[model samples]
Target: MADALPWQQALWQQLASRRQHAHAYLLHGPAGIGKRQLAERLMALLLCQRPTATGACGQCKACQLLAARTHPDHFILEPEEVDKAIRVDQVRELVGFVTQTAQLGGRKVVLLEPAEAMNLNAANALLKSLEEPSGETVLLLVSHQPSRLLPTIKSRCQQQACPLPTRAQSLEWLAGQLPEMAAGEREESLALSAGSPLSALKLHEQGVLAMREQVVEGIKKLHKQQSSPSQLAEGWNGVPLLLLFDWFCDWAHIILRCQMAGEEVDLGAADMHKVLQYLARKSTPSQLLSLQDWLLAHRQKVLGKANLNRVLLLEALLVQWAGLGGKA
Candidate 1:
C-alpha cells in the first residue's frame, strides 16, 4: 500500500486516539487528490483484526481481501452510470449492507465514493443510516463538493477537508516515483499536472502531456489576442471544457497573486497578463469573486449534462471577463 498523504495521516492519528469515533465521516476535497485511496486505507484500519492506529498491517487477512477487492464486509456505493446521480435504491442497498452482520465478525466498512453525486432522494434515504448507524459499521462518504450535499447529511457526518499538495513537494515526490523521465520532462509534467502528482505521472505515462501543452499554448494565444476563442476552440473537440476552465483558473490565480503583490509578473508560459491586467483595472474584488462564481456555475452546468456550445461559451466568458476591466 502507498504511504498515506499528510491529511490522511492526520485523520488516522485522530481515529487512533479517539475513544468514540464518529459513525459517519465526510471526506471532502478536490477529485484525484487520493480521497478514494485514503478511504480504502481507513477501511483497512477499521476491518483489521490486529490493527494499529496508524494503518493496517498489510499481511493481515482483511487487508489481503481488501487488496483483492473481495472483502465481504466492505461495500462501495457509487453512481450507477457516468454523469448519473446515485439513486435512492443505491442508498437503500447500503442501508441493508450496514444492518447486516459482518461476515468476518469484525467491522463493516461502507464507502460512498463521490457522495455528492447522490440525488435528493438518495441523500435523504442515506440520512437515516447516518443518524443511527450500526455499532460496528463505519460509513465513509467522499465528496469533491460538500456544498452539493444535503445540509442534514453534512451535519450528521464528521467533515475532513483535503487540499492539494504544494508544487515543490508534489514534484519532488513524482521525481522519486518516476525516474525514467528527464529533468525537463519532469518539470513540464509537474506544471501540466497543476500540483496533482498522480495526474502528472498519469499524463506523462499516457504521452498526453504534449497534447495538453498544445491546448494550453493555444489558449495562451487566444488570451494574447493573436487568435480568436472560436479559432482555438475548434481544435479541441474531444478535450473537456473543464480542462480549459482549470487552465484559466490556474492562470487567473497567478495573475491575482501578482496583482495583489504588485510584483514583476512572469506569466510563465501563459500569455494572459494583458487581459488579466485589463480586468483587474476595471473590476473590484467583489466583481472578481462574482466572476469566479460564474465560472464555477458554468462548470457545474456542463457537468450536469447541460447542452452548451463550447466555442460560444468560451467566447461569452471572455466577453464577461473583458467587461470586468470596463468596470474597474
Candidate 2:
C-alpha cells in the first residue's frame, strides 16, 4: 500500500472503494495541499499488477519498476521548465503514447500536473483524448486552478476537490515535519502559506521569515523616502517574483481593510502592523484599491511568462506604493 498522508487516509479509502472509476479524474484544489501526492499514489495503484484493496503490492514486478522510476505503463506530463506552458507538441506526444498498447500489458496511467499550465492548443488537444479515452487507461489531471482549464476538458473528467487542512491539522503536520522551527515561526509560516501545511514547511526551509523582514524594511524605507526602489530591487533579485508580488498584493489588501474596517491585519509577520500603519496613513481606500488592481494584473503577466525587466518592474510597483496618496 502507498503511504498516505494523515489527512489523505479517508480520501484514499473512498477513491479505492469506488465501484466504477472514471478514465479521466480531475484532482484539484488549493496549491500546497496533498493533491499531487494523492494522485501519484492512485497512479501507482492503477499501474501495479497486484493492486490490493489497500493499494499496490510492493513485491510485484510493476511495483519494482515504479520504484526504479522505469514503469512502462506510467507517464507524467508537465512543464519541462518552471513557469512555462505545456505546449501542444507535448500533448501530441502523449497521444502517440496512449495509442500504443501498454508495454506491461497492464493499465496505462498519465499524470498531468498543474493542468492549468497547458496552453490553449494543448488543452484543446487534451480535450479529444479525454473525450475518447483508450481502454484500461487513466488520465489524472492535477490542477490548482480548475477555472483556467477549458470547460470541455473539465466536463469530461470527474472532479475530486482537495480540501485545505484546518489550522489544527496544518500546525500538527508542520510540527511533525519541522520540529526545530520555533512556535512563533511555525505560526508565521502557516499564516504566510495560507494554511497549506506542506507550503508552510517549504517557507520555513526557504528562510522566507528572514527575507520577509528585509522586504518589509525596504518597503518602509521607500515609504519614508529614504531608499531607492532600484537598489531594493537589486537586493531582492533572487527572491521569487510571484511571492514578492503576492506579498505586495496582501499589503495593499491590508491597508484597504484598515481604512474601511478600522482593523489591524494579522498575517503573523513580525512587522505587518507597522507596514499596515504606514500604508493606512499614506493611502486612501480608493487609492489602495487601484493599486490592488494593478498588482493583480502584473501578477498575472508574470505568471504568463512575461519577459519583464525585474528591476524596472519592482521600481514601478514601489513608485506606486510611495505615491499612493499624492494630492495631484
What are the lDDT scores of the predictions, listed in order?
Answer: 0.74, 0.83
My TM-score estimates for the predictions, one after another, are 0.77, 0.94
The pairs that clash in candidate 1 are 282-327, 282-328, 283-328
**Decoy 2 TM-score against native:** 0.94
Q: In lDDT terms, how accurate is model 2?
A: 0.83
Query: Model 2: per-residue lDDT, tens digit, 181-214?
Result: 7887888888888788887777777888887878
Model 2 misplaced regions, further than 4 Å: 263-270, 325-328
Candidate 1 matches the true fold with a TM-score of 0.77
- Best by TM-score, which number? 2
Name the best candidate (by lDDT): 2
